[model samples]
Target: MQQLESLIRAAENEVSRQMQVCNACRYCETFCAVFPAMTRRLEFGAADAHYLANLCHNCGACLHACQYAPPHEFAVNVPQAMARVRRETYEAFAWPQPLGALYRRNGVTLALATAGGLALFLLLAIAMKGSLFHEPLAGNFYAIFPHSMLVWMFGAAFGWAVLALAIGAVRFWRGQSPGAVGSAAAVEATKNALALTYLDGGHGDGCNEEDDRFTLARRRFHHLTFYGFMLCFASTCVATLYHYALGLQAPYALTSLPVILGTVGGIGLLIGPAGLLWLNLRRDPMHGDAAQRPMDRAFIVLLFATSLTGLALLAWRDTGAMAALLAVHLGTVMALFLTLPYGKFAHAVYRSAALLKWSIERRQPNRLRIGGD
Candidate 1:
């Protein structure tokens, strides 16, 4: 344990040193969602550091933005450094084995099962009322279920899931402590790194001079998937509210919204995994230090299956085949959600927290200018 602590401290120190040398030029702002918040002032400080740390979404935008090349560049590797901080935090604050285990495989399995059950229930309700194809083209498919029941079910399920995730994250964050020695400086450095990554824009030094086709494509796919999910989620909320809560029979056309969103989202999700799989297949993993993990491949395969199944459901909504597709789609979605806390998806929550932390750290006087082009 002592050796582990020493290694972590060394890593933190090295990362902090690299960050302090950063000039705050705000070149990577476009990639960072928290840039606007960090640039509220010109000077960087502890608060700003914390905010920046929490604000960074860890999308790898800043890494691509930096002009610093390996072996000679002073360029800040914000993502790596932030990750180090997260690691440190985890070491200091994460709960004991059994509790932490609850956030892992067992927890994910239970959540997936619960989500699958709920989705099955919803799908059944739609089928029983003969609403699945009630107005296939017109989009008013939601008119079949009891509005109140739909609203209550969806609302409660989403609320509970979100709450549980939030609680787990809070506990994780609260576990880290810098200790008394150089605590202030270490925390401040952490904040600065976060701000730099979350708030800086313009691709670091200048335009991306390196070959980043794969990276850019991956990022775009992710963005599209996010937008698609947002649209689907919004449509669900609207349907529930309009049909169930307000007691209004919305048009069949309303159903098309989620379908369209789902289709687009499915496409993006598929593209992302396909691209990654292709890259992994072509690359010689043994030749480089950056070899892909087996789990990475597993994640890609799962996402691909999820997207394809979803698209299949959308394409064959009327046939008996649709039932099987629907089952696969629901299963995959459940798997994705349940894997959230432990898999790469954990980055979604950890990255957001890191960004917010960066935002708070960089909150300094006389540095209120938002960084951007």
Candidate 2:
């Protein structure tokens, strides 16, 4: 308990110091929601820092625009400071606190978990078919594992991820002391979250990472990734509806809605995650917390692997390798869903909640009265 408190104090102190400096400068206030939110407070405490940390998008635009950055006496780096506290928040508010340790060495844990899942699925396949090499099974994934069995396995994992993420988001929201949110604010927040308005650097341009140069690559990639995941999810939902409602079975045609959506979404996932992984590697170390690299990379790699394997399975569905590819793809997907809560994916959930709070708070009159309209 004492150790946790100390960690919280350290994060809060760093965030507070940076917020103080940024508030005084107020040059980058137009860059993102974090600055405008920070201006609402004359002083910051643990809760305020926590709220601001999650509210930050860590786009690195503020750092590039800040005159007091680094070599300056203030040593202000908003993205880095907020990132540190954001990591702490993830650990502190994680559904199962003990499992939160996975954030550290997350890459190793993710790889091991994925390997274990793949091996388990492959073993099941071998047991079911009684052979490692089976004849081309066409598009009948149920040949290896029954649809009921697949539903039970993946349904449980997906349900758990949703529950854990919900609990964590609720916990964080309660901690922020958000008052009643107006309907307009709620709609605006939803729009901001879906569009990732803040990541656009508060303008149509883009964010800064390695240097002062602005680039829209990150925002575009994120759009692809987010929409791709959604499309894939929609495909799954449609497939379920077809199975239960329309009596459609496995191996929908290429022209089918489900297949088309999955194909497009898979492509987007490939490009988005690949681009994100590349940017993550090339990103400036000083922009965000360095220690969070493993967590970030773990999620990115899993997403990319999931999409890549799924696409491969689609392309080779009629080949003898189809069964093995299907197992590998299912395993990667299971890993992705299982680790969704504990991985860097939780950032989106928490950030969306923070945006809701910010939008509501912004509706309220600014108490600081620092920036005149």
Top-lDDT candidate index: 2
- Per-residue lDDT of model 1, residues 1-373, tens digit only: 5765675566556544544444365554455444554345454443334334445444454565467623446746665555544434433333342333332233323544654675677567557756543334332223344446545654564555565557646764554232232455456545544333322233543112123322343344455545545555665566556566777664434155545565666777777677756654554332111311343455566667667776776666655444445545655666655444334444455555554444344443434333432
lDDT score for residue 332 of model 2:
84
lDDT of 2 at 60: 88
* TM-score of candidate 1 to 2 decimals: 0.55
Least well predicted 10-residue stretch by lDDT in candidate 2: 103-112
TM-score of each: 0.55, 0.96
Candidate 2 colliding pairs: none
Q: What tens-digit string does per-residue lDDT give for candidate 2 at 247-276?
A: 999799999999999999999999999999
> Model 2, clash count?
0
lDDT of each: 0.49, 0.85
Cα misplacement distance, residue 127 of candidate 1 (Å): 16
